[model samples]
Every structure is written in structure tokens, then in C-alpha cells.
Target: MDSGVELKKFGLPSQCCECGPQKSPALCSAIFATSICPNCFGMSVTPGTRYHTLLNTNEPPDESELTFVRSVASTVDASLEYLDHEIANLPENVKRLEEKRASLLSYRVRNNAILSPLRRIPPELLREIFSWTMPSLEGTAEVALCIEQTPWMLTQISRRWRVVTFSTPSLWSQIFIDYRHSHINRDPSTYSPSLMKAQLDCAQKLKIHFYGSQGIDLRPQIDMFKLLSQHSSRWEELSVELTAEMVPILMTLRDRIPSLRRLWIQWSTVEDQTGVHSIDCFQTASSLVDVGIFNDYRFVPVLLPVHQLTRYDMDCQLEEHIRILKQTPNIIEARIDIAFDEEVGSDSLETVDLLGLRRLYISPAGVLKYFKVPALEELALDIYGEDILSLVRSLLDRSSCSL
Candidate 1:
């Protein structure tokens, strides 16, 4: 190796035998520059990085340096032994550090519980937040018949939350129960009356949705319907689709549902065939405003306080819908799928003016001429591509409304 390169690598003086270890690099350089032999520059009294350079500077080491070579070899062996001993303790050291880290993490979680943001929220405010998460029973949206969810789940949080949910009457007032929740062999207790009884007892003004099919031995559902019907005075809305003498049972509560406002009724019969039942069970409901009757296959004429209705969604013939719209001039939204043996010609169909109607969803767009919706804002028509432009233009122009 070159002397200058060796000097930078070790940060040490390129010493001679005469110039000792205590001498500075500058002193050594000056001593070497003035020395008689420039070849003896790298020889040092003690071992350093320059010592290796000294050994490789010329030929092999002389016999006089054998003892010094053995001393350096022994020093390297002792250093290796010390490092290996330290490496053996590494696993124990890592285990202790990991234990400390885990303990500190758990301590932080425990301490955070006292000042958690959930703890800061009041019980009434939490109840309000929960109401938005739960489904609204008044609408047509289907809700699952699970007791281990929502308001029930909220009560399981803690004692304070349980008391809060139990005290909130609105949380328990709305329920949607289906007959399929019960299985004779698998889980018969799924739709037990005891659960409904507890739910009804906690509820105030109720919005109940009861759905049951035909020929399923809907004994549990019937029992539940009987339980819910007892609280008919508290009813604010009823979406009924059940069988097994549900009609006569509901008939007893004709005038009793005074607080009822909205109704969705669908009659069920043998083998899923739409049964004909003249349902006026909810007719005397004084506060009723919204109504929907499923009449796609068979139209069961529902006698409602039609003049006060704000919304009507019925699947009936054109003539029948026109007859209903005549009674419901105040209807704001209408979704009518007209069933027919023959389409009614625009000239012969009666034009009913619904000045208050804002949204109209009609199937087969050909029936647009029957209603003159002057205040129409949203029109949903089901038709093919070619007939769209003409039908829509005619409806908009004839209605004389900005849609």
C-alpha cells in the first residue's frame, strides 16, 4: 500500500522504529524526511493499522518479529471470545425489552378508558346517534327480525347505556316482524311471544310492520299479531301482510287505530295467489295520509280516507287508478302500475288534474294522458327508447307544468 493512503486509512502516523508511539504524525514525518533510510518509515514499536502496511511493505517478516506476530494473534482470539459471549446474551435482552413494550401499551389502553370520548358523550345524545343507525319501520324498507341487533345490542353495552335505551320510548316503538323468523325444527323460539311482549311493553306510539305468508302454520306470527294488536291504540303506522285469520283480528281494531297515519296492506291466499279481500280495516284511521296497496295480480279495493292522502302507490287498472285519483286530488306522489286487458286510448281516458302532485312514477308511459300533473317535478316512466321523447314531450306540454 502507498504510505499516503495508509496514513488516511488509520488516521495515525507512519512511524519509524526510532520515533516512538507518543510522537505526533508531523514529528514522525519530519523525522522520516530527514532520516538516512526512507525504507524504514512504516516500522512501529506498537501494532496499528500502519503495522499491517509495514509487514506488506517489503518481503516476508524476519525471524526477529515472530514473537510480536504471535502476540497480535492472541489479542485477536481474546477479542473474538468476548464478542461471542455478548452475542449469547442477546435473546434474553430482546425478551426483556419486548415485555416492557407490551406492558406500556396495555397501560396506555387502561388509562385511556377514563378519558375516552365515548365516556364524555351524554346518554341522551348517544340515544339520538343510535336512532340514525337503526332502520325506520314506517317506510317500505325491510328490516331484519333479529333481537340481538340495534336497540337490543345497544342495551348490552353497559348498565348506563341499557338504562338509557330502555328509557327512550321511541327506540322501542318501531318494530318489523316476519313469519319466517320462526322455524319449527331449527329455531322455534326465534319469534317467541315473550320477546314481542317485552318489546311492546316498552314501546309508546308504535309503527308496526307484520309480514306473514300463507299455509305455513303461522301460529307464532298469529300470536305475535294478537299481542301487537292489543296495543292498537298506540299504533301510528301499520304495514300488514299476514294470513291465518289476521283479517278478523285486525277488524276488531278498525276505529281503535286512531293514531295511525300510514298504511301498507297486501292480502295473501293459498299457493301465493293474491286473494281478494275488501280491506277497509284501516279506513276509520283519522290521521292516515300515506297508503300503498299491492294489486299487481289481483286488485283488492281498499277503502281509505282518500281525500286526505298525500301519497298513493297502487298497482291497478287505468280506470281504477283514475277513480282513486279523483278522490285523492291532494296526492303529492303517485306510483301506479296500471294492469289491463286493453290499453285505454288517450281520447277516452278521463284527465284528472292533480295540482299538488310533485312526483309521478307510472309504468308503460302510454298512460301519461290520464293525469294532468301541473306541479310535477320528478317523472319516472317505464318505456322503450323510441317512444320516450314523444311521450315525455306530450306529458310536459299537456300538463302545462315546469318539469
Candidate 2:
């Protein structure tokens, strides 16, 4: 037998029993079990001499081929009917599965809501956790970002959280106002009066920091100062860095800051040679016990309540440093950074006796020989000049105090 003829016999029929014969001739149903005609199946011969002899002839088989094809047609029809019935029920089966999946998901969500751990935390403890989110009111930029981050974020979480955050006064007590760089370009009217009032209303004691950049107009700063000055009695600490033009506005608060305990001020770099402009307003601040002055050469001398001050930090010339110390006889701690422009004539200067001084930090150790701190227990000298060791030894011997 030809190999091509054997290979052709293995090919699938162009037509099957379910659809009857197609335009192409029907395949012999004897070799294939699936979709075979009954007549073709009866005509199929066993793999022997009979099958080989049938392949050799070109003529078709007689009644046996017709009977086999008819029989196969009946069997295929019955099988297709069973498959159609199963396929017809698939939509109902799919609908039931989708419903079960939805039910399971809903039940899981309900169970999770009932078991949520956050609902178990007490209100007081929750408020304390929110409080910790507030940034420390030290640096200028950090404090500005904190206003929008902590209190605002907490209020947005829930109604109860908003009430708790607003009731907590300490969160709003520290206020930092910086008008440096781009911040100075904003319109003064845009500053929120309501927000400022809310902070003032809630806080018992306020710590205010107001900083200004060079070349910025003092008009906006003066307006801000006016608003803050209204509540000066509540200010516990005030730090202001302003231009020389803004000093007069600050001096307006001298007698008004009755509750102020600490004050820090820095003037613009422009030198004040007349020595006539002084911050005499703070002279009446009875509660003012600590004072810090920076860039003193740029401003007229600042007049502080020196006799009542327990701590003083002065960045000034040696003459001004001596002048402030001589007035502050009750100072217990002092940090002095002397400017190098002027030399101190020790022979012409009188010795300042700081009887209550316990801690002293001084740069250009040559200044130590000018002070008589008998009660000094802690001393830090910035060893910048020659004879620092000798100066310290002389200070130790003159005070007659143990190191």
C-alpha cells in the first residue's frame, strides 16, 4: 500500500453525523469512533488481508458502508443532546457562585469593623498621642510647617479628635513668625487673624519668636508686633530679630510685658555710633530675669533690668560687656562673647564682683581677669588668645574659690 494513502486515511472527516455530509466527500466512519456514521462503521474492516485488499481497489463498498454510516449518525446525535442539556444550565450555576462570593466578602468586612483595635483606646490617651505629633517650637521653618501638620491633621481625623485637639492648649502655645526671604513678599493682610486669635485664646502662656530678613520693610513687622503686643501680659518668652527701624515698635512694649521672663533681641548689622538709642522699655519688666543681646554694635545700648537678671548672654565689645555685668550684680550665670574691634584697658577698668555667679562662659580668656566671681563653681574658657592658662590661673587665685 502507498504510504500517502495510509496517511490520508488518518485525517479527520470534513463532515460529521450531526451535520451530515459537507461539500467534501464523507470520511470512512470505520477508523474514527467519535461523530462516525453508522453505515461507515459497519463497512470498516479489521487490520488484516481484508483491509489491505479494500485499500487496493478504487471502487466503493456496497450496502455494508451505508448501514455503518446510519448507525454512527444515531449514536452521535444522542451524545450531542446530552452535552447541550448540561451547557444550557451553566448560567444558573455561575449566578449561584457569584452570590456566595459577595456574601463571604460582606461578612469579612463586618467582622473586621467589629474587631478594630483603635476603638478600644481611651480618649485621653488618644489625645496625648496626637499631641506628640506636634513639632518642637524651636526652629523657624519647622514651627511654620507644624501649624498645618499636627493640629490641622488631627482635626480632620474625626469630630471627637478635633474637639480634643482644640481643647489641648499646649499644642498652640508656641508661635514662631518668620518673614525671611519669600515669606516677606506675602501681603500682610493675608495673615490669619482668626487663627492667631484662636492660639492666643487657648494658650495660658505664649512663647513668641519673630524673625525678619535684611532689606524687608518694617511695616509688616510693626503690624504683627501691634497684634502680639495686645496680649503682652500673657507672653512668657519673646525672641525678636528686627532691623533698626523696628526697634522703636519693640520699645513700645517695655512696661506692657509684665509676664515676660526671658527676652532675646538682635538688631540689623548697621552700626549705631551715637549710643543714644536704647531699649529702655524693658526697664519696667519686673518679671524679666533672663536677657540675651546680639549684634550690639549695630544698635544704641539696650537698657535691661540688670539688677534683677539671674542669667545674661551678651555679644558685644569688652566695654559694653563690662558695663552690663557691673549693673547685673545678682547674675548667677553669664555667657559673654567679646568683639575684637576694641581692646580692654584692664588698668583703667574696675573689677566686677559677681557674688552670686555659679557658672561663667567667656571667650578671649583675657576678659576673665576683669571679673571677681568668688562663688563661681563652673567655668568654660574659649582658649582663643595667648596666656589663656595664665589668665585662668589668675582668675582661680583671685576668686579664692575651688575649681
Candidate 3:
């Protein structure tokens, strides 16, 4: 609107005029430094300000000038329409995504400001948070513990985040009882039973692995067993990897735990026990439903006494093993690892009479011997020579056995 700045003409087409129609000769200079219609100065142009500089310099109307207003109007209308559709169709999705983003940012801020200063937090809260995010039955206990110890970024940023982290019970639930996955040596005495007891006090399932250097202490093993016995009422699953010294404790647990539905035991060393002393420990646990056992010796068949057991797994290769396993009346599935015996005459042993067995695994040796087993969905063998393969073929010839 300054007087010194003469409004020049931007000689555009009549259709591009600011006003509907013009009467005077178009000077074709911009009124200001805008793409303005020259006939009626800038007043007759569209609502947007236009430059006069281009027309004064003999330049044609820019493509930007031609379409800017219309395109802007179209974009605005389209945006409003899109907003309306999105509000109706995907409101929750948009809201959740935005909230997640906000949560991430808030956590970052908190980590930078608060939790870094106060290193330790209440055990309960730490355990709870860990329970929410820690890998469930997937990761090793060490890795899960390390992840739980990872500092909350938001807590590092401010006091409020630290307070929230400290107060939340979910944070503490992350502390789980890891008996099987955590590294355990011969000295069960060295284990922190109190800490484990506190964390897994309410746990429904527990997996414990036990190994030894030369031998294990009987007393500590008994103490550990006592701890398990105390909490056995709530236990739903139990997996125990045992050494020879832990037999007494293992045997005692059958009577103590009434709620156990699943049990897995792998006995590495039996301390050269014959059937005389071993049979005393065999007690039929009625509640036992699923059982997997890895026995080193063929003479001991402790788990076979559980007649009510429905599922059984034995990773052993004894020829007469199935005879013991046949004691389980209701067993619908049995996975037995059997070793081959070449010296034993193929005709001496009777055919397997597992009337209820739907699954069986026989070593290549067992396949070689003239054998009749019940209909099995799966069978595997360790083949040493062509004789074994021939035996397998001969056995499968009776039925089409696919690997």
C-alpha cells in the first residue's frame, strides 16, 4: 500500500483476473512484489497476495501463482474430510499409537532425570516390573535377571519416575524362581534358598536342575528338599535334574507334594544301586499325570510304579525296559529310547505288548530283532550297520513306517 512502490501489471489471461472482468488495458506489471492482476491493481485479484515483480521484469505468470490458491483450498478440504473419516474409522488405533509414543518419550525423559541417582529399589517393585516384560519360559534366567536390572530411562530423568518405579508391584514380580535354568553346581548349600523362596513363594511351576563335581552333600540336598516340600501344596510342575546323592530327597517328595501334575527327572549317576535298595523308594503318586525320566541303569524302574500316569518319557536304551513300562495301565503315550543288543537272539524276546501305547521309539538294534510292537505314530533308531537298516526295513515291512 506504499505510494513509492508503484503497483505493476502482471498481464495474465482475462480468466486469471482478480475481478470477474476488466475495462482498461493491462500494463502487465505487478502492483507490489506479488503476482497481482494489473488491470485493477491487486484489489481485483484473488484473496491471496500476488507479486508484481515478475511481470515488471517481463516474466510470465509463474505456475505457482496460477495454482497456489486452488491447490491450498483443495488440500485443506481433503484434510478435513480425511480427519472426519479417521475419527470414525480408526480412533482407537490412532489414540493408542500416540499414547505409546508419548509413553516412550516420557520414559526417556524420566531415565535422563531421576532413576540413575538412586541405584537400588525395593525388591517387590523390581520383581513386579520384571514379571511384566521378562521372557516367559524362553530365555535363560541370567539373561532375564540382567534385563530386569536394566534401569528405567524415565526414572533416571526425574524423581517422579523413580517413585513410580519403586511403588509398582509389577516391577517386583519379575523376580522369578529359576532352579533349572540358573547355573547350579555340587554344593546346594551355597544356593540362596531364602532369596529364591521369597521370589517364588507364590509360583505355580518350578524347574530345578542339579549337577555335581565329584559328589553332592546329603544334608544340603535334604534341606533343599525340605524347602520344596514346604511349598509343594501350590506346585503345578516340577523338573528335577538329580545326582546320586539326591535320591533320598527325590523319593521323599512323592509323599509331600499332592498338587503336582507334571514331573521331569533325569538321573545322571545312581551310585551303583541294585533293585534291592532302589525298589523301596518307588511309590505310586496318584496325582502324577505327566512324567519324563532319563535313567542311566536298566535295573531301576522307579517311575513305572505310577500306574495312573498318562504320559511317560524314558530316554534309555535297555532291551527289557518296555516290560517295566507296561506296568502303567492308563499310559496312552510312551517314548522309550532302546539300545540294540546283537548278542541276544532275535527270537528269544517276546513281541512288545503295549496295548495302549500310541507312540514308541526303538533303537536300530531293536528294529533288527524280529519284533511286534503296537501301532506307533513315531519310531526312531540309531543304526550302526546295514543289518540294522535291514532290520528296520523288515520291521516296517509289516507296516508302512514313515520316518
Task: Show model 1 residue runs off by greater than 4 Å.
Answer: 1-110, 135-147, 181-185, 269-276, 345-348, 384-386
For candidate 2, the C-alpha RMSD (Å) to the true structure equals 10.9
Q: Output the TM-score of candidate 2.
A: 0.68
Please, what are the lDDT tens digits per residue for candidate 2 over residues 1-403? 3323432343323344344556222343342334343333323333443333444567565565445435445666655665687689879878988899999999999889778776677878987887788777545454562336666678787677787878887766777777664654564443466667767787778888887655566676667767888888888999987665566667778678898999898754554223445668888898999998886655356788888999999887777888888988789999988874556545887888898899999987877878998899999988865687788889989998876
Give one digit per residue, the lDDT tens place, for model 3 in 52-116. Answer: 44324555656755564343345445545656777787878888999999999999997875655
Q: Pick the candidate with the highest TM-score.
A: 1
Candidate 1: residue 78 lDDT (0-100): 56
lDDT at 290 for candidate 3?
82
Taking the tens digit of each residue's C-alpha lDDT, what string does model 1 give over 250-363? 778878888988888776654343453576777788898998888545666778888989999987888888888999868999998877546444577778899899999988
Clashes of 1: 0
Instruction: Report the candidate with higher lDDT, 1 versus 3.
Output: 1
How well does model 2 score by local distance difference test? 0.71
Residue pairs clashing in model 1 are: none
What lDDT is obtained when candidate 3 is compared to the true structure? 0.51
Each model's Cα RMSD: 10.2, 10.9, 14.9
Name the best candidate (by lDDT). 1
